[model samples]
Target: MSRQVQINKIVGRLVAKKREAVSLTQEDVAGRLNLNTESYGRIERGVTPLTVSRLVKLATLFQCGIDELVLETSTGLTGQAQYIANMLDGVSSSDRDEIVKIVEKICALSHKKHLKSIKPY
Candidate 1:
């Protein structure tokens, strides 16, 4: 796949995962985003390209940044996330929930640490 396509897939997986983490079904996310299930499904599948506006709405809804939603990676998502998402595919639903929590925590801490390292002090 092209890098863009891979990025899209990674973004889609993260969107799907965040939605699930919040106990929001695809239909729920679609409804909240003022999109039909099919349209939202396409977004989640990386079949439809995202507009900046819609991406903002998704980031707001997911309580994340636009970059976090679209950049792809645990860091930016990218192809790396696709492999990780695929590995996560085999985890049972309950275990997956725990894993997601851990991943989110790690991401948050890593982001904080990164910001700290960038300080000129």
Candidate 2:
């Protein structure tokens, strides 16, 4: 399976475990998240992509740091990826998403710069 899929499953299991720890049922979590029970169940099953906004809510609901949700499953991350995750640890998910977009833009610009540096025949 893909790395993303593995990560999603790990995160999902953690979420479900946390919810259980808090003694909340799936219906309770769905209500708090403004999701239907089935949709929330999909998230728990790793069948749905959890949005940053939702993750933020989950962190708040669970009274834990965002890093706590992700850091454990991120054992495979190395160097810069791990650093980036650390930097994003306590940040709001929306801001984190925006930062990712900016990084993507910077990558695009860097690619263009590299192309311009190519020597012409």
Candidate 3:
């Protein structure tokens, strides 16, 4: 397949994931976006190209950015995140959540420290 086809597939999968995350059916999303159910299904299956306005509407409906919908999230993970995932392998979901919370706290503190060090540049 061409690069555009691959990208379309990624975007479709992301849109599907976002829709499912919000507990919306394809038909529900179609209604909200003023599309028919069949058209929406085609979009989710990567066979339909979304217009710019439709993409914007989808982003709004999903409470996410257009980039988030178009980008393949698994391919965008940071090296640190990959390492964390490796360490989290086989861990329980609750434990993984706790570990992520700790990491987030540390990252927030590091961000604050970095901000304080940027002296009016």
Candidate 4:
């Protein structure tokens, strides 16, 4: 399958899994996300693309990170998880590690910047 399709599937499955883990139904998740049931269903099916905003919301609602949702290899997860596992399978270990480091540095820098923006009481 194409990489885009794979990513969508992974993201969709993770969202669905997280939603279910919290005992939330598709309708419940859809309501929280302000999405229609049909649209949300399409997302879970990987028939529609997931937006970054929706990804952030899903991570928050599911108490997970985008990375976790995108790198899962378990079948118990929603279809999205299987897609994530497949996509990650294509990555080189060295490249994955390097990317992780880069992301960590970026997060650290962002945290520092946020701290700098706050004034002392």
What lDDT does the true structure give each of the candidates? 0.80, 0.84, 0.84, 0.80
| Stretches of candidate 2 exceeding 4 Å from the true structure | 73-121
Error of 4 at 119 (Å): 67
The true-versus-predicted C-alpha distance at residue 93 of model 2, in Å, is 30
**1-121: candidate 4 lDDT, tens digit per residue:** 9989998887778767777878889998899999999999999988898888888888888776676666665456566555555456769999878876997999899999999999999
Worst 10 residues of 3 by lDDT: 71-80
Q: What is the lDDT of residue 105 in candidate 2?
A: 100
How well does model 4 score by local distance difference test? Answer: 0.80
After TM-score superposition, the amount by which residue 12's alpha carbon in candidate 1 deviates from its true location, in angstroms, is: 0.6
Off by over 4 Å in 3: 74-101, 104-121
Ranking by TM-score: 3, 2, 4, 1
- Tens digits of lDDT, candidate 2, 1-121: 8888888887788888888988899999999999999999989888887888999999999887676566554445474687677568889989999999999999999999999999999
Q: Is candidate 3 or candidate 4 better by lDDT?
A: 3
Which segments of candidate 1 are over 4 A away from where they belong? Answer: 72-121
TM-score of each: 0.56, 0.58, 0.63, 0.56
Candidate 2 at 59: error in angstroms? 0.7
Candidate 4 off by > 4 Å: 74-121
